[model samples]
Target chain A: MDEHAHPSVMTFVAVWITLLFFTGLTVFAATLELGPFNAIVALGIATIKALLVVLFFMELHYSTALTKVIAIAAIFFFMLLAGLTLSDYLTRGWSTYPSTH
Target chain B: MPDSETVSNNLKHHFANLEQQTATSKFGMWLFLATEVMFFGGMFVSYLVYRLSYYNAWVAGSQTMEITLGATNTAVLICSSLTMVMAVHFAKLGKRKLTAIFLIATLVLGMTFLGIKGVEYYKHWVHHEVPGPNFHFEHEGNFDPRHVSIFFTLYFAMTGMHALHMVIGVGLLSWLLILNALERFSAEYNSPVEIVGLYWHFVDVIWIYLFPLLYLISHRHTG
Candidate 1:
């Protein structure tokens, strides 16, 4: 792998513009009434912004497969943390446990 | 010269080649960032649980935040990330002066973010928004002050942790600036710059999520 072939400045500038656009979009989107959909939309836009930064600015797009897998693994575990915990918290009231008293 | 022996002097004796060294450094950085994800993830979970349990109170607490400052800080961080990526790009091109200039630009933007954050914190303090005895949540509806204080607790915990990382990032950038001044990096051995860029971008990414989760969650209610 020739490590010297970095992303051109144009590519970085383009990514920067896209990131700023998404930032504005997320903030603006929050100002609209969307009920439960508001959070979903905000987080969705944020995820896209995060992916752009990860792929372009971090050079993961040009990295090796192992590095890519390592990155995915990190996200996988983070999801596990959030998902598993939220599942419990969201469902804790479904059935009542017998009181110790 | 043998290919192995021809590798740059910056290649460590233990590594087979420059590529290996660079990959190892990147792998280590990603792994460290993974740990940081968990570190912040805990707080996020805490916030989610409390938010679900006390929805209106969370909204009330979020409304107290200054949207202008939060939005401005987000833009500042996004621009700083651009400078950081530019620094890494120049380092790869062996342009020492450009890299140093971008690094300095990133440092300035990072400090600007902290300055704005300090002002926000000061405003909260003046308004008695801190989560303890002096804390108060002003709302015209049925909301428990204690639960609203919980929102502030999460706010301080999450943003305070994020700010701490920014402070550490500024310190690391300062060290990189000194090293760059001494000509310690070149095209073949700018892994430190690239690695630091990963750390800096990861910090920015954390805020990318934090901005929406903390400030924009219930913005329309107050708007």
Candidate 2:
């Protein structure tokens, strides 16, 4: 518990405000018909908001390099899960296979 | 006991020092959170596949959601995360009373979020939005009824799982509050508070993604 490492009250408040601002931005962006960009923009804002919470509120910013690596690894693996699975789903029709049914 | 003297008393026999013990506990929490990320990741990926396949139904189903309530719940969760971190800060500073106060504030905010979610659930129930035979969407003509029901299924499953996490978090905080009252934690040993803070913040992070992914899809055209 390093006293110097603790975040200031102002920092927490600022992060809170920023998270709220991003939440509003996501909702607003969703309302706009940006075609494919709508999901991208909404998720992009959400990722930023999640990053702020992770770094500040979760104190990952003050944590060690090992801790940072572990955190990033979690996200990386999750993306792998999403990406690999989506690839299979998206390309399922590219090759024909006999239906079990 | 004096604060300096208490530091040694707090050190576990298996750990070399307080720093190692704290780091180990934090690492354990991170590992648990990593598993949690995969747990929710599975659901989110399923959602993505279905959403892409049933784009119009997903959009129509998302439009039926009450954005105001969802946004308000997001704000509440964000504020709760703030209070939770402040509680950890105060606990580390050995300000027992402030730590307890902030923890209670977080608990109340968590309950408030759940209460709003309950209200939303009730509204859905009355509107026949729950996925089953009674399910009804005002925009049913625009998309397949089954796909729209699939959207609601994902909605309930995702948000319900999230709410369950919040409930568990509230329980954890309540126990922590009790421990704080018992003078169990001090500046020398606040790992429990810090670890729980990690968990609470992780839940908030999930909602940060869930808010947009579930509630904000195609809201402008539908609402």
Best by lDDT: 2
Q: Over the stretch A52-101, how does candidate 2's per-residue lDDT look in tens digits?
A: 99999998898888888899999999999999987887788755321111
Q: TM-score of every model?
A: 0.93, 0.93
Q: In model 2, which regions exceed 4 Å deviation?
A: A1-4, A94-101, B1-10, B138-140, B221-223
Candidate 1 docks at the CAPRI level of: acceptable
Candidate 2 positional error at A75, Å: 1.0
lDDT tens string, model 2, B21-93?
Answer: 9899999999999999999999999899888778788878887788999999999999999999899999988
Task: Give the per-residue lDDT of model 1 (tens digit) for B175-221.
Answer: 99998887778766788899999999999999999898889878855
DockQ for candidate 1: 0.46
Q: For residue A44, what is the lDDT in candidate 2?
A: 93
Please give the TM-score of chain B in predicted model 1.
Answer: 0.94
Clashing pairs in 2: none
Deviation from native of the Cα of residue B82 in model 1, angstroms: 0.5
Q: Score the docking of each candidate (DockQ).
A: 0.46, 0.52
